[model samples]
Target: MSGLRVIPTWRHGREWLYVCGEDGGTVAWYDREADRVSLLDEARGGDALEALRPFLVGSVAVGPPPVPTPAELAGLALHPDDDLAPNRPGEHLAVALDRDPGPPRRLRADPRRRALAAQQRVGEVLDGLEAAGWRVLHAVPLPGGTYVHHLVIGPGGLYALHTVPARGRRVRVADPFVTIGRAEPQPLLRRARADASRCSYALTAEVHPALVLVTPSSAVPPAPHLFTDTTLPTLARTGGHLKPADVEALHMLARDRGTWTRA
Candidate 1:
């Protein structure tokens, strides 16, 4: 007996069974979805097969793992400190709040909190689009201390989304101007378009601009690009703009902090 054991693990919603030696080192891993077995230690192939026999539903191609793609290679080459992939929704705001929480009691709520809530609400919906071949990067910092709230790339193409906090308030849009409730109109759409333009310059690709309204009471004059939290998932249904590889490549580029310095 080779004294090998099989351990099951899950990554990105996919199941894998790993064959380990007595020393607790992984010898091989079987990906049932891909119907492949990747051998970490070629010499232990036989032991790995034996250990994985029970979990093997059928025949699987046995070999080393596939080579990383260019996008993946770039990602792997990035230093941890320079990588933005680990950033959460409203990462900049979250950090600021951590550093300076502001007054404990306030007559009015901090606008940053409202903005963060909007970003997080939209981010949750965007994250769900990954199942449909979409990738989303949140809180992408740009030059001059400005940042993109969310950058989405997928078969539908690239979008720079700016979240608007309009909870229970009516929103009216007229090109560059956006009016929320009784507050004065703001050139939010213009800002969104500018953000997309900056992203396009940074990545050398066209990036559509869109405003995401969070739980709005009602939005006036339906716009083609404007999206509400409920309708944001429809982006996954739109396709033919780019291939899967393109989406991944763009995502890889967008997740690097240095990539936005040019913007």
Candidate 2:
């Protein structure tokens, strides 16, 4: 107890403070959002409470950790290698760039780099929604070499998002086609919808498709399925489709890499 320490950590956008013993083992943890302190070593409860006194905001429930839900148990049983929960926004692209970064002196910036930037930007906004009862999975791989940019689950339902880099460019959408700046139009919406369909088939739930534009100068027509980085957080304000437990179960399933092998 002489070397007790309080260490802070973040997960799913929630803050947790762990009280550690002299041997660097967690004796207790304080969940700030839940307003609870769970003791791993009941004998050290006094030391843990003392270490966390400076960080506690108000009166909090102090006791043993709650029993794990079915989803939590499943997630805990998953092997790290087969878990997609740790993936960043542009996980595949990040790995590719790390392995073979291409010519350093190219005349133009790599398009993959632009796409990765867009994904990361959108991912930040989605990650922030975790506090609002939303769960997001990034870079979900499919049967082929393709991937869904991001999969979101919440009270608003599920969505498969595809990110488009339109920094400072006008965007036009006509059903399946999307035109950006002076570039030729592409059927990006169709691809997004297809990805959502695949996700639905894999998860046995209706997954909506959305095309997310990053920093677009302007997006015309304002379709329901079209979103910008600035407007994406609005999804968190939507509810009525699922409860907390359903969201957790879907998230646990979505984070398992094996769940997408047949999609």
Candidate 3:
């Protein structure tokens, strides 16, 4: 019961509740209004309210993960004009929270909810990369309530990757911008670059900027103009520039709490 937690999540932009064990186990997804829970195996066959009653009675965060709080976000001097400024849709809520610095904002339309798919995609890719001798980290917290989704250290080189969820859609990347279906090109390369700089300083190593676009239905192949294609296999195969010791050093730095939380 101590490890039980309920955090806000979404399935395709719709409110979907997520429950998991802090000690690590299969995550359970719920839909309170629908009265259902989604199994890890993609099957749907459980009573959400019934299964979650015990946990919910005494514990539920109902917001973003605990790593970065609103007060924490406020401490960082992330001015509006700063490159690391919360400019995109993803950064707004955290920045807003910083100004107000109160209890976790209500669950309605949490911006972090939108990054769930990207996190899952990045997690899958990083899992494979870890299995294949790559050192990786995910959901790395930084100042200003922002998070570094994925960081890879291996022979290919150190990479700070930002995930773009473009699944089941045609994605075309044309430098500083990416077009997904009819949507306008949302430029996130700068975000990735800023993340890399932060990682570089944290690990005291040069980090490369990269973007992973999760597209299962892209008719066009990845090109340099699109930035490096960051599929699971692509990430697992490339970036072999770090040695074992170097990788260890980076892992050590990444795990060090001061590397990120410090101003």
Candidate 4:
């Protein structure tokens, strides 16, 4: 793999420098230190990769652009399911023009869309955490077609967070489960617990499972519920004795596509 290229992106909270191959849909991401790389797919893998190169190798540096607000991202024509094509100016124009080319389409209330929306909702929360020394990853697809919404690390600790759609509803956790307007908590709690366990085993750390509910008119108790406007003081309480190095390690492991995707 002599001509492999990658683009640097920041999403959910962490920086991802990855390559979406020209043909294979294979992905590989570099660690923060740039000393290591992990491939997401092995079916089209190679052991003799050359020195990695940035997608914008010769781009001229201009003044830094202003930070984008959530509104801007909302208006942008992008989504988690969109393909990350190779770096070429007009490469995507054909695909874009071939698309519906009309107003964006709204998806039905299906499991996949729910998961994607939950990931987006949690992304808004992670955006605020950057200043607080937090790092997060979103939409991590695991085995069996399941997705982990947000994996967060900060001064408080490591968390496997899931955003539950509970708009206009008051949600409460009654030990080992959550309750939202007559909805049973066991299913949600069980899934969250299993996801946390999987994340913990993957990162070799004790990951805590938490819920992020979307409610505009209710005050979430200062517990596992992480509202977009409130501080999750309890979530990243003390880093769980995790140091910066540990956090980076976990981030790299979680970012590795192979960690979640099976060969």
Candidate 1's residue-wise lDDT over 1-263, tens digit each?
89988766532335677676766666788999999998878988988888888888877899987886898567645554666776778999999999999999999999999999999999889878878988888889999999899998899889999999998999888778989999999999899999999999999999999999999997545676699999898898999999988988888888888999999
The Cα local distance difference test for each model comes to 0.85, 0.88, 0.56, 0.55
Off by over 4 Å in 2: 1-11, 15-65
Best by TM-score: 2
Q: Quick one: best lDDT, which candidate?
A: 2
List the candidate numbers ranked by TM-score, top first. 2, 1, 4, 3
Ranking by lDDT: 2, 1, 3, 4
Task: Assess candidate 1 and give its lDDT.
Answer: 0.85
Off by over 4 Å in 1: 1-65
- For each candidate, what TM-score against the reference? 0.77, 0.79, 0.54, 0.57
Q: Which stretches of candidate 3 lie over 4 Å from their true place?
A: 1-114, 220-230
Residue 178 error, candidate 4, Å: 3.0
What's the lDDT for residue 151 in model 4? 74
What does candidate 4's lDDT look like per residue over 108-202, in tens digits? Answer: 44444444454555566566776656767766667786667677776667788767766576677665676776767646767778898988877
Report the lDDT tens digits of candidate 2 across residue range 21-59.
Answer: 656566788999999999878988888899899999989
Q: How many backbone clashes does candidate 3 have?
A: 8
lDDT of 4: 0.55
